[model samples]
Target: MSLVIDIHTHPAFFEAINADEERLHLRQTCLGLYKTGAAPLAHIFNQMKYAGIDRLGLLPLDLTTTHGVELVSNAEIHHLVSLAPEKFIGFASVDPRRKDAVEVLEYAFGELKLSGLKLHPAKQKFYPMDEGLDAVYACCLRHNKPILFHAGISLQPDAPSQYARPEHFEAVALRYPRLRMCLGHFGWPWVVETAALLLKYPNVYADTGLLYFDSAREFYQHVFTRTLGQHWVDRSLRHQVLFGSNNPRFEQIRMVEALHTLGWRASTLELVLGGNALEFLG
Candidate 1:
């Protein structure tokens, strides 16, 4: 059987919901927006089981200063990874603005034993190429762990969307030539720039996240045939494409189905569904 990995997810976003009283009031919080298909840990696993997701890249957001939501901490992610080592791959998050951010990242990798790093530049309010992150990038390069960056627009009210554009990644891509970086959301409306980066930098990649929200045909036309063209999409897929559900915001099974609607050949389908992720995360 082919393996499937979801490289982006906010499983611990609503960690407070685990509390009895908070669970009852979950409908009132910002997380309540996902009340429809989103469920507790057990139900989330059930969904993954039904969707044939063998593994997931569980990401914790460190938006403490920006959104006052530090619910998903590195410790929480570590606990989850420890609980289900075979199913969950923890990706630690650290606000680059913090004084000891580099130390925290070192602790996450050396002590916590996390697999990778996930950053939301928009919420974190920093550019991907910010010189302050050089230490963090160097640490990632030393550990050989990939970094998933939130690109394009952000939903956070505190975010200055300008900080998250795909073009901004070029500087980092050029500086850390061997550092593996996956631009999340395929940079959405900036898919062209995302595609260009994928072509220009051997270590740069992207995931199909919110882009699948549109119909398969529309998505295909806009991303592949219309904007970047079929040839560009095909080449990029062979090298840098990875499947992602952006779960809780969207269903995993539905995202899988959406990829099938694109009508890629058997080999390409296997790669996009899981093969690329295995390589990227390695």
Candidate 2:
């Protein structure tokens, strides 16, 4: 049997909320592209079916303070998982700057039984290696839960691009050598830093989420084939790459097909498609 795990997704019940100019622009851009408002749970399941995905990972964003946009809370994610335990695995979020942040994460893991944690440094207005975040990393390390960090540019107007750079995450990876971490979006426009981390640290990995988007395909094609050279793809990649569809932005099945265009070996294909994520989630 084949198993495909889409490890990065922002499945949400989106609603109009207050936002800065940048946030408003992003909202309009998405609305123009996807031509929809909210991606309710039922619609998400139908997309999963179309993609032939066996399990879906749902990530919640916690940018209440920085973006002033109300987001799907960890509690809501837990409830969604409960609604369809067999189909969904929820990844919780906690803004490290929040008071009692570690405590909130403890409750999320202990009470909610969330499968993983998602961090967006840019939106949260902290560098990934910020000393203040040590406590949260300690929580994840102790709980043996993987963290999916947003490791690229964010559309939020106030977001600092530097905070999301993949290299900063190298410091955290070094500090907690055993903690599993994934840099989502292949750290686009910084693929070199993202690839270097993947090769240097056994615990660090990346996902092909929005890389398959129409605008990003050319960039990824160059990275996989030309920019980094073939060895990067044929050897350095191996099982460190994972399949992820940032659903609603890109269709999952189409993302799978986009990856197939690379013409990787059968074993590499299997690992990238699902095997790697299963091992990471374990």
Best of the candidates, TM-score = 1
User: In candidate 1, where is summed lDDT lowest over 10 consecutive residues?
Assistant: 23-32
lDDT per residue (tens digit) for residues 1-282 in model 2: 368788887665333222244554455453233343554567667777777787888888776666554355798788778878998889989988887789989999999999889998877889988899899999998898999988887654566778899989999999999889999888876888899999899999998875533444564566677656656755777778888877656666767766766757777878887888887887
| Poorest lDDT segment (10 consecutive residues) of candidate 2 | 13-22
lDDT per residue as tens, model 1, 1-282: 589888988774434334544533432254333344325677667878888888999988776666565546798889888878998889999888778788888999999999999998987889898899998899899899899999987654556679999999999999998899999988877998898888889899898876544764466556756677766656555668888877766656777776766656777878877888888888
Mind sharing the TM-score for model 1?
A: 0.89
TM-score list, all predictions:
0.89, 0.87
